[model samples]
Target: MLCDNERGVSLGTVGLKVLTSKDAKKVYAGIVAAGLRAKETVLETAEKVQASASDVLAEAQEINEARNEEIFEENK
Candidate 1:
């Protein structure tokens, strides 16, 4: 028997048991929905990671600029 959970319906019994048309449709829909949710999460996480990387790069550039200015002043 297939189990239902908070995440989604289980598909573990797909090949183990024979399913009716209605049950098959439900399984297909669940799979599609899960796939879409996964894609959205990936995109969201990627955006966050990209933004963080940009911030780190900007900070590094600022630090390098400050060090260069200090060296220039010391030489003068």
Candidate 2:
């Protein structure tokens, strides 16, 4: 249902829409787009974290190799 003429508005889940305006539907779509963008940002942050973890693991492996070589020389 639409709002009363006195209010000039409609109920929206995340954003307001003018009751009689052309973009009332657009208003709802914009709210949905905002939600999608927020979700996309979370996914992007997760990808960066995975990349950082892989880099750290690679560095640790190189250090282990050097340490193993040093231990072998000492034993010899």
Candidate 3:
């Protein structure tokens, strides 16, 4: 099931069932489309998280450098 996959469970024993009947093709298509959309959302969110983390790291480095410069100036 999707829950097992989402939770990082091993799916060796899992069985996937997507109706492939002539009348069910549209249903299968909709399911695939929805899954693709969800994947896109997760990717976008991960990118945002990475960008925010990098920004915070850069700010901290800048602050530390400024403090070091101030100390160096005082010692001169």
TM, every model: 0.71, 0.62, 0.66
**Rank ordering of all candidates by TM-score, starting from the highest:** 1, 3, 2
lDDT of each: 0.84, 0.82, 0.82
Weakest 10 consecutive residues, lDDT, candidate 3? 9-18
> Against the true structure, what is every candidate's RMSD?
9.5, 6.9, 12.2
lDDT of 3 by residue, 9-61 (tens): 44433322234455578887888999999999999999999999999999999
Best by lDDT: 1
Model 1 misplaced regions, further than 4 Å: 1-20
User: Candidate 1, clashing residue pairs?
Assistant: none
Error of 1 at 45 (Å): 0.5
Backbone atom clashes (below 3 Å) for every candidate? 0, 0, 0
Candidate 1 local lDDT, 1-76, one digit each (tens)? 4346622434435543556567887998999999999999999999999999999999999999999999999999
**Best candidate, TM-score:** 1
Worst lDDT window (10 residues) for model 2?
Answer: 8-17
